[model samples]
Target: MGAAEATDVESEYSSLVDFEGPDDPSHPFNWSLPRRVWTTAVVAVLNLIGTAASSIFETGNGQFMKEFGISHEVAVLGTSLFLAGYILGFLTFGPLSERFGRKWPLLCGLAVSSLFDLMPALGHSLPAILIGRFFGGLFGVAPVAVFGGVLSDCWPTAQRGIAMALTVSLVFSGPTWGPVFGGFIMGSSALDWRWNMWVVIIAGLSATALCVVVFPETYPPAILRRKARRLRKKTGDESIRTASDKEGLSLQEITRVYLIRPFWLFTTQPILALLTLYQSFVYGVLFLFYQTYPVAFGTNRGWATSLEYLPLLAIIVGIFVAAIGIVIHNQLYFRHHCHTPDGVFIPESRLPPMIVGGILVPIGMFWFAWTATPAVAWASPICASVVIGAGMYLLFIQGFNYIVDCYTTMANSAMGVNGSMRSIFGTVFPLFATQMVHALGVARTTTILGALSAALVPVPICFWYWGDRIRAWSSAKVATF
Candidate 1:
């Protein structure tokens, strides 16, 4: 009660409040399981909506072209621009999350993205719709950046495989189902191109509401740092400090971390560099197919309406089937042996599924390209789509797991770089797809893509064999198994 005693107590409290670091239990990884799962689910849902927005308007493209009196290429820009916005958004959001914490940035991004989704419905002008789509993609990238980080934050390496599988499944499902659902909606006499945007907006709003209500802060450093600040304020002590507070890089330092590290990893680590290139190509091919499919199915086959291609839902079914195979492979790998020589029991050991995916990519492409003729049964291209989807899911899931495993704390930055590369390809692929198909025809164009995909198959095997050496030589920091 004495003045001296009160001063001493205040000094003690200040010290306690200053303490911060990785070991703090308040971090998201240390949260109870139920809370972490809820956070992960919210992130997955947000990602679903973001991806859904990417291609939800595919079925509506013809309608827009007619309504706006625009060329097919110009209308397709709406889809391409959304992806470009995602690329632009990735550059900012990853670092922002690192600085401010995940919750606020994610919420703000989702709210804005959802609002943009509504803008397309408000006007008939092409510019307005394009602008709205661009902004939606811009905000949508927040979930893309944050979701992987959230998984890294809450789940230890062991449990991350299944969590990642599920997250990725949801993300892919959005785009996969986008066209299917869009077809259904557009097929309905009651709806038009605008309905596609509304569907996305509704989905975004629902996900955002759930996130706001159920998701809690999960980043450990941010949580503990806040707790330390509060404790300091209340107790009037000075000694307590967090590891992050003591060693936490300044904003400039963090920026340096983000900018410098990925390049270093890409340049020095052949594995990363090659993987980035390969995955970039795969992504390009995937988006290219988005443009190509309608041409092949709707135009070439003389499907009376875009809705006739609804049977292409078989592609998504293929992806889900491949996902099941991935899960089975993962379980089998774990059951046999769980640890590497280094004594690290990495769940990354389950990456063998990628090999299956690698095989599927080229095979599916070749099949679809060759069979995409009016003379052939429509079933031919649909079957090829199944193979391509299966292959894509396999490759994507493996690549994601590989990166997350390799870059533990820095996974967000790595993913941002990967996303940037992927988006660059996504943006470029659509622009040239028509030209490519025109020049080579669907079969030859796809044959080239398939061959390119085939070439990359060996890359993963090389990584599986020599990944350790490559990681050692690379300057970029990676988690050791």
Candidate 2:
């Protein structure tokens, strides 16, 4: 009789502990429009600050080389090591967000990263600067690793595309913006490379402070756990608990969730593997441009140091234009699929823009490859960068949305896997970027890049037509809707 009574109590408690209803005001998805918009913007800003730290130093590479008496190759380590940190942070933070929640992990990461940002700003030796830069990147990537999940938690699938576009544009543009600001500082007679580090430190700390005040916890499980704890105190019933409370936090569970699962999904999921590799290629090319841009605009065209970084703005312009297009398209076409009764839209619905983006990338690369010479008008290559930027943005935003849609619950792990590869490529590509351009010449170097991008142009198109079938073969739990 007692066992039966306990079973009845447990059943009643489970229902009580869930969201009051789908419209529960405490739920992130049910938050007010203004709150959601502000949250999304704040999250985007955090990502921007994190990624911007990686390349701000590049603008002052010349000064850094002179100050430290290091070779150009050694100086490049500052940027490469920062990217390497992305891999570590992504691997660690993604699962941490899954287990713990988004807000605290994100907050802790930003705070620590900001503290480390001081390494580059005040380090008297090259080793200190490099170590600081690496750790800064390692912790800073928390936003990059987990913001996708935050946005996922806040926005429903239908409205997510535009929000994602706005966020990703800022995220991708961060590296370019770093150089833009750093250039003016480096060009100033009073400022030097350290000022760039200071700029990152200020931005990072400011972002951390802002998030602490405004950011709300978004992860569903984490939020529910908190609610369960509150109910337990209010009712004095220890049985008031969430499903997650029953799950073990053992070492084996941690290892499986953090390490084994991500690797398994990365290897076994074909759609994930192919898209990840394509995105990695695109990412590597973007970093490669950091090295090549100086050579093309400053060295070959004899542009002023302060002005050379200005052309990279063309990428930002393209990113802005592409973002608007994505938002508009999502409103018109993609939103319909998301409105389905089951709320299970085909993930392939996200691929059309990616197809157009794929075509644009190679065209822009080839156009810039041949026209980047001094004799050619500078505006020609700048215009080409616009195309490249637009293409890259489309690929980035759509690919990310597709991954999230395909693997609904496991999106964080999938993204972490994808981010790790992208970071690896971003890290290694620049180490030899200068050598590649010098040996192959600008035309040949860019031509090779163009060729690589062109080869993958079919990726989105193939996925568009046959993605449903491809997704069918996945062993992991894919979204059925």
- The Cα RMSD in angstroms, rounded to one decimal, for candidate 1 relative to the true structure is 5.0
lDDT of 2 by residue, 1-481 (tens): 5999988867755644678789999899999999999989988888888888888888888888999899999999999999999988999998888889999999899889989989888988999999998998899999888888888899986677778889999999988888888778877999888999888888888878877877899998899999988878888887787877756678987777677777788878888999999999999999999888888998898878887888999999999999999998988887776535876667898898999999999999999999999999999999999999999999998998888778767777788899999999999998999999999888899999999999999888998898888777673344321
Candidate 2: the clashing residue pairs are 344-481
lDDT value, candidate 1, whole model: 0.76
In the order shown, what is each candidate's alpha-carbon RMSD? 5.0, 3.0
Taken over the whole model, the C-alpha lDDT of each candidate is 0.76, 0.87
Any idea what lDDT model 2 has?
A: 0.87
Cα deviation at 64, candidate 1, in Å, is: 2.0
Which candidate leads in TM-score? 2
TM-score of each: 0.86, 0.93
- Model 1 spans with C-alpha error above 4 angstroms: 1-14, 17-35, 229-254, 304-309, 334-338, 342-351, 475-481
Which prediction has the highest lDDT against the true structure? 2
Can you tell me which runs of candidate 2 are displaced by over 4 Å?
1-16, 231-239, 337-344, 475-481
